[model samples]
Target: MKFIHAADLHLDSPFLGLTGLPSSLLATVRQSTFTAATKVFDQALAQQVDFVLLAGDLFDRAEQSVAAQAYLFQQFDRLDQAQIPVIVSFGNHDYLADQHQTVAYPKNVTVLGSQVTTKTLTLADGETVAISGFSYPQRWVASDPLPDFPVHAATDWHIGMLHGAVATGSDDHYAPFTVDELLSKRYDYWALGHIHHRQTLNQQPPILYAGNTQGRAINETGAKGAYLVTSDHGHLQPQFFSTATIEWATATLDAANLTTLTALGTRLTDWLASQPAAQPTLTALTVTHLQLDATDLTSLRQGEWLNLYLRTHARQLKAAHRYLVSVTPQVQPQALTAPQLDQQYWDQGAAAVFTPANLQATFGKLAQEPALADWFTQATQDATLRPQAEQVLAELMGKEDPDVS
Candidate 1:
């Protein structure tokens, strides 16, 4: 009746967008995924949960990381020793493929296959639970897999494990299913995955995404962990637990009186000393309500200021157990209102320049590099790129006085 639900382990994956970190912090980043995952296993052993459900993306198969494979084998073996059953449904990142078919996990680990299947386990407390799910055969499912899922089984509890997304009507590569479709099956619980933000779609039957085990990037900020679900008064309840050794956070600093890089560094150091986190935090700092000359703004924009601050303020950062991942200027749209240029013109310019084609054209040869291309693609899809574009335009406008006549 009790189990731990987790997803998107992303084991042995390198932390993205990190540069010039301290040697000790860099080592922590390398082991963060494994360390976070160990907390989940540790919880399982301590709580003596009947089973564990890993919804999906346990690891990126494309990376071919030996450390990830070995870590899973070792952990699964540990779970087996504790007589805890682990049900895993691999998502797109670690889809079922021929290359890793030969390797076997421990006896307690049951990796669901490509076809929709149900695995039933009888708990020591005499409760029978049926878990139904499927692994991604390849990178994309591209279809409604609801029809393939069977009806609720004749057991004490029925849980559906899905590594997919909500139906977006078009261009959905992952297995897409609506909440209605999930509720139609009348399962006791839905352990969802793929989306890296934890959310609950329904409360009664406990439909949820456990999010990623650790925060890997600035966008994946805040507490990162899994859920421990237990049956309570005929209803299943999920409680979150933090597993991340290092946390990612974004904070806005008021730069009303700040005019120079030295002042910015002092303010940042003071801010770090004021705030604290239980775990080492990697912070993305944004300056607001500030006016800077082109040269100073360019330093921040080009990361020259941030790099210099990191080097000079290493002692402060180390004392706070924090790292400044980025320092950005929040340029308000109202600040860009020029005497000659109208808001309409700015909007028109944005419309013309911010298109995907334009971005791709501007990206040019850099797109040829796979890593940069992937980053560009994800950045374009998210809202991160628009503000950057706006900041660039604001800088250009700040430098030149345009004539309407």
Candidate 2:
């Protein structure tokens, strides 16, 4: 009873990292889906996995690109030929808004229809696996839907799949759920998604999120891949596999005492060399750096040459790793720590800024400002969310340059 469990294949995801991707990587925007889907298909074939579950997010948007659709079809074709069943359901990102139509997928594809229900897949050997799945009908479902799932049902093995959050603290407001509530279902395995970071929600019965196929943004950094689940003497766990064509990485070069760009270069060189070397055929890399101070050190190659400088070092990195460095300095730290970099002072400033009253007052005053009128109007309606917004705004304002040049 082995299956390849993957989710959040945000096909044709515009760009893998973030806005303003380099020109060289720009053309691959629409082709990201194809690249990632191709890898998944190849991996599935190599692993000879019996089933594949696309827990949700089959498209980046409701009206996904034709190129993306074609690419998906091609992958499904391969799966069909291999006789592996691919089970799919629409996630919030690819929900009803998803205008995907007019493309003929292989018979092996099981596009789960809307409305929460169970689909039973009986293998050729007469062993049965029931996938009790549900999908996001809209962009947001604020209510607790975990209670809606079938509990302790009769089945060989029940794999419950849904897309939401299961948390205990204030962060639970993000998606809202309780592990104890999920436990009521008593399913054999839970293949989940939505929160795009690989996590194990329940070790007792094994509830897991495979995370996004590839890191879609800078915040979605680090290793991105799928999971392979197998039962050993009726016990199971997941093995994380790296199938991402392009890897997104971030390294912060502390430009503190190292006042020279040459030092920064060598520092960056060491960091790049440190990245775990992956397979030979992988996509480019984006490296963002946060620097301090602005010293016109001659060792630092200026303009286009800087990238080339890093590229030269990147090439000398591990043999299997191929990457493009994306450099971003975090407001140049010396500037931030400077007396006026932010009206930002030292201990007192950081403390006063984080204080609740100061944050609320600052946010309330800023909310009254003319420039923020529209955003203010929209935010006022939700009383529960007001404090969060205020806290965030206060942080931003507190961090602003005390002297605006």
Candidate 3:
């Protein structure tokens, strides 16, 4: 039997914090989610798969996007016409709620309830398949869901669908479950979601995450798409297919050869001309070993120089099918020193100051604010925070004492 497994459609996701981009690029970004999703349905129809499994996060209900709702209904109806079934389990972002129940999808679509239940399907060839999963009752489950799931059913194939993360033993707000727990169920395949990067957790029974159909942020880079799984012998094999209309990437440019901004511009243009992309690619570029003067380097890092370059070389950017999302100097770690102190002293100081407890204490009451608190929580977990901080400190100290470094 053959089927499609996909998750995290994130339909109508407002690609937030992208106001700096041009209107034309912004329009493409806005439509990218829908475009990516359409490709999944198109693939389903073309491949003539028995059914499609949408593990979770089809859309964010908070956006209140009518377009997203309409689009799903239209796509489901199309699938219905082609006699293809779709199984859906809502994730945190699109948790099971009253609004979802009120507006039912096409008859062919089977949306799992809030409680763990098994949906059995009989394929055209008279083979029985069992899919087991649950939708989030609310935004956060905060509990282990493994206890609710039963052992593999007495069918030709048993697939376990889960939309959560691995139990980290702490701070697991989603439906947490362990790989060993899932393996105990003895299911033929495990389809996972929640995490946006596609990965295989097990090779034997074929447990994997389909990832998001489209990347919504800069951190989610590379080809985003679903998996086409086919039963081979006694195992299910999954093949990845790209669906993202646009891609995100981080690249570094060596600038040790050029000393002037004029030369830099020409070099950047030539680089863009050489590396043409198949589709629109949003790039976060870092210039390393830059030979420019302090003022020119500051201008480049601060966006003053890059802004002029982008405006002047709009045609070049379009030709290369790339957009410079941000340009920053590569922060090379340096031994921060003082007239009387050594690198060891600086390291010791940083170790004491950058501790999570100390950072939280420093944040103090500002942590009461949810937005800032979340940012602080992530910041505290950043492994490179101390090194980056040291680099910044060294740069500041160099202005005061040239002999310090």
User: Could you tally the backbone clashes for each prediction?
Assistant: 0, 8, 0
lDDT of 3: 0.85
- Against the true structure, what is each candidate's TM-score? 0.88, 0.70, 0.87
Residues 1-405, candidate 1, lDDT per residue (tens digit)?
A: 789999988886777567678888989987898899999999999999999999988884445566678888899899999999999998877787733643588899998999999999999989999999999987778899999888889999999999988988865767989999999999999999987789999998989999999878887898899999999888899999999998988889988888887777777888889876667889988899777887998889899988888888898888887888988898766355545668898778878887778878989998654334435655336377877656666767766756534
Off by more than 4 A, model 3: 97-102, 336-381, 397-405
Candidate 3 has a TM-score of 0.87
| Residues 264-371, model 2: lDDT tens digits | 667666665665456422333322343433443222323343555545664555443534444434332232233444453554555655554664566686644322
- Model 3 scores worst on lDDT over the 10 consecutive residues at 370-379
Q: Which ten residues in a row have the lowest lDDT in candidate 1?
A: 370-379
Residue-wise C-alpha lDDT for candidate 3, range 307-367, written one tens digit per residue: 8888899899999999988878775677677656676886688778877788668779986
Q: What lDDT is reached at residue 288 by model 3?
A: 82
Cα-based lDDT at residue 172, candidate 3: 76
Question: Each prediction's Cα RMSD?
Answer: 3.6, 7.8, 3.6
